[model samples]
Target: MVRKTLISNKAFGFLFLFIFLLLPSFISAQTQEYKDYTVEKGDTLWDISQKELNDYFLWPKIWKENPEIKNPDRIYPKQKIRIPLYLLQKEIPETKPKPELETKPEIVKEKPVEKIIEPVKKEYLVNKDILIAIGYIADSVHSVGKITDSPVDRTILGKDDYAYIKTDNPVKIGEKFYIIRSVEKVIHPESGRKLGYLIEILGIAEVVNQENDDVKTIITDSYDEIPTGSLLDNFYEIEPPLAFENPRKPDINGYIVATRQLHIINGTWDIVYIDKGKKDGLQVGDILAPTLQSKHKIINGLIQLINLRESTSTAIVRKCNNSITKGDGITSVK
Candidate 1:
């Protein structure tokens, strides 16, 4: 009975020792599956989350993986840390992330990962209100209505004046038309090519009375003189939703064709028209650098494209080194 008891005690001791010896190796083997990282100077969990996953909000998940990190905010240099790949599948924006782990973790035998792609974002430049108000160049003018005559026999129209309008198209009672006039025909200075007519927005008119094709409209607002022979177009007020500031450098070039105020010399806050436009990979919010040809390229100022057409763009001078003119050479810039 004594020998049997002694044999039983020996077997139990061996079993306990075996488990104790294998425990550390089993834990280490499991940990080895994940890549290891050592904390460095100026390292914060918040920064780590963004640097690793492109999301600063995921710091708590990273902290949960590192149980030894008693205080997430109090990490030290050379401190060994385990920042495991927590999610098998994650949706994140495609960004260049700098991971503390120098190498890509070969953490196979785990759940598979799925990465989703999202659209890239752009920088906002100007107010849409100001953008829509800026005049743009067009190849042709299509007027839905025309100002045939005015009440009280007024030759020159101003604000709050009644005008008789006629259109072949259907006109509603509340429909609005923009009183615009062809100010001048734009001719390319260098090439001597006829670009288009510059349609100036004089005022806004709203239809109040309509009898068959004869429509009566009241000039709601006027910026310039609205003559009797002025043309009426559909009211345009929407700006581009994707119009953003240009972040890329100059790859395409164009020339200034006209100015918004018809100024011979344009300065800050002046809107100018450019020859390069949407067809030339130009878009709203693109920054253009106006340069002067000399012994060296002279950068006069910068312009931000507020409107883009097929072959023309309207840009507001954001910066003015000297003065931008009608024929200044332009190149796209950040």
Candidate 2:
């Protein structure tokens, strides 16, 4: 004979109440329906999301619901995945019977109000003017116009100097463009990837007059001596940051490929170029530190990204006990 355990009336009442409360959620889960999809050749989760969910960015949602998917990028043929229809499709409105209203006496209770403390924006070490001069590397810069010649017989141009810009594109009066020089291309030391080109900001120019294919402009702001044949593009607005924004990938790391001024040895306040850029989720106001195993650990310091491009970023050494060298690996601190 099977032995039976006796329960008290009070214990049975608690168990009944718990089961009564959880019964609705259990029933609701059973009613929830999920559409199934089979992975086919040449089909990516992103493409599948767009076809099924009507949004490409919602692929993560589909990936989350399916635990078997080992990798988001790699889904083999004949693999089955479930789509959460509640997230994919919109809800249909339903009408229900309204409850009858009953009048009741009002009662007021005094409660403590909770307060949320906001973080204050901290000013960055460098200002806009300094940032403009400390230009970052980019994959490519689309030059809209190029300086052809100047009214004065001079090799280099400066502020208040009038120059003729040649371009097939249309020009507008009072329109402004950044005067820049394409220095050279930078390559990743370890990855061997073409990071981008080094672009130096020379100055700013404003369109004054247009004659056929030539647009006459006056140099507005001169950071460095502008030269003939310098390319003109839209000006970038750089501002001093409050506190450093949290790194998109907290553990993201990259190499310090090069240093500013091509120094044989680098120290604090020196500008360094990182291989990682916007593609790697790096952004302005991000703080980076030399990895523990990186060379010159005694001189390792923190670097703050001042500017970013598609393939690279320019950072300033904000803090360090010693110094950093090219090829030293750096990781996000915040």
Candidate 3:
């Protein structure tokens, strides 16, 4: 009886030792499948997700692991990224996640990993109220010249009963002066967000002569400050969702919302300044559908039918139009 008891104790001790030695290796093997990645030029999270996980939208999952990817906008070349692929697959039901107590942990025999893919996201159109900041186009130093077209002098002359601006410098017959207004956002019908502002051409003045940087100037026309509720920018004009019937003809499509006729920059080729910006869901490389309009007879009424008037002329968004105004043209509606 003594020998039998001793034998039973020995068996129990051997079993406990075996389990203790095997537990850590099992856990370590299960969780050791994650890898790291380096971001190269033109590397995008969506592309990497597609290559690694076969789903582009799954990028947010990888982004959760790396909190440093703030402002999904600013990515540098050759940045390192962590790719987490070690989690065991639990079949998440379509409706809700399984409760922890209800699920049993299963060991993975092997870890499968995929190479990262860099995807190019197409640009998309958006319109929203955006904040506009003013900068100096040209600065004029003081010039002591005759002030013929002073606003106070014009009031004295009874030329017109209105407030006018004047300066003591050289003046010309057809010069233009600008009353600049800042930009802001409005409501969007599609996305339900307020974005972008409308830049308005306020007034025109002309230069008479130059003293130094300062010049004598006269107001040619008195224009009002762009009032509130003015039609600011047009987000929908990035691409008219229509096609042109004739490809050979030079088609006029949408209306111009804003323009920088004087300043042409890279990425602004043949592109008109728009009212819509990134706040309106606009992206950098979306293909916009150009369209046209025609009057058609519907049931018992006259309806304006917008037609897809042309082939898809893709507009690469160089910059978001932050100051779209109402009644502004998007593109030629052909």
Candidate 4:
């Protein structure tokens, strides 16, 4: 009887060890499988979420899974990240029901009602002319003159300030010119070739005197601070006709290449640079819609062409469901 009991005890111990060794493997197999992703250059949480989870708004879920990423904006390339299984599985959490609450009777009081008449507010849509008038569409191909000197010791010159300009080009006395500075280089979106320089209007000046290569001028109107080396160009005074009368969509399709402030993200009233221009048959007062590339291309915003160059144009954001960003496609619209 003692020998039989010993053998049974040894068998039970072996069974226990076998179950302990196999338990971990069973648990691991039952768990959901996660895909591993290696981060690449120019990768952002927003973009990764869009690529992995099919929703750009799910960036927070990605951030929650990677606790080591303290700053979601500063993630580096070559980092290994696990795309959570929950995101892939599309698991919906079970919601708990609210407990029933005791109700109390409320007292109602009757009062005399009066009819109120409110004035209707008129809605005004933004037009291309308005954008040009507001200095959002400053573009000039004519080379003016550069400010060489200012009357006062101040660095910035304004209206009524005397400024000496130097230009190889001839300027007629009493002729008004726009003071501008080259700010950025505009590039083609697809070919990535340099198109032209974007000039910013600094102020306005009129030629007071002409002597050799030097032209004496006085700042007449200032939009921004007029500094030395500001180039002078022919003032654009004629306003293009507004297309509100007969608006029509163009057949040409393009994409946003840049913005006025050179921002990656933009919203309503912000100026954006498009690949389409006069060469592409885009004209002033042409309206375009900014759209996202999806299974069913959705337009998120509206933009109006205000300034057209040879191969590019500047547009003002008229309306947007959300903020417009770089890489958003553009299509002409009525």
Q: Write the per-residue lDDT of candidate 3 for residues 1-334, one digit (tens) a residue.
A: 9999999999999999999999999998677666678887766665676667655445556766777875343456788778776422223334675566666679778777887897743321211111011111111221222223343344232112222334344345345444344433333333444333433333334455555544444434333432221221111212322221222222233332323322111111222333333344443333232222224311111111111112111132222324323333343212
Write one digit per residue (lDDT tens) for candidate 4, span 1-334: 9999999999999999999999998888566466778999867665687788876445666776787875554577899877888786685676797888978869788797898987642212232223333333234355745788875656778778988877666779998887877777666656787756666666778888877766788887765567787777777674444334334468778887766542221112367777777888776767789987555678886776667777777776756787777667887553
| Least well predicted 10-residue stretch by lDDT in candidate 1 | 260-269
lDDT of 2 by residue, 1-334 (tens): 1222344666788999999999999987776678878998767665697789775446666777887765454577898889986876553455696887888969878797899997743334454556776666766876888898898767799889999987646889998888888777777778787867778788889999987777889998887778899998886566765433233325677788777642111111367898877888777767778653444443366677777777778887655566667777887564
Task: Assess the local accuracy of residue 243 in candidate 3 as a C-alpha lDDT between 0 and 100.
Answer: 21
Off by over 4 Å in 4: 1-144, 209-214, 261-268, 293-296, 332-334
Error of 2 at 85 (Å): 60
- Give the clashing pairs for model 1: 244-285, 246-285
Checking candidate 2 for backbone clashes, the offending pairs are 122-242, 122-243, 299-322, 299-323
Candidates in order, TM-scores: namely 0.55, 0.54, 0.31, 0.52
Steric overlap count per candidate = 2, 4, 57, 2
| Tens-digit lDDT track of model 1 for 1-334 | 9999999999999999999999999998687665566777867665676676665445666666777765454678898766664431266446785677577778679787898886653222444434444556778886877888997898899889999987758888989988777767888868989899777677789999977666789988776677898888888676444432124454777788887643211111477888887788876656678887555778886776767788888887756677677877887553
- Model 4 C-alpha lDDT versus the unseen true structure: 0.68
Q: Sort by lDDT, best first: what order?
A: 2, 1, 4, 3
The candidate maximizing lDDT is 2
Residue 118, model 1, lDDT: 68
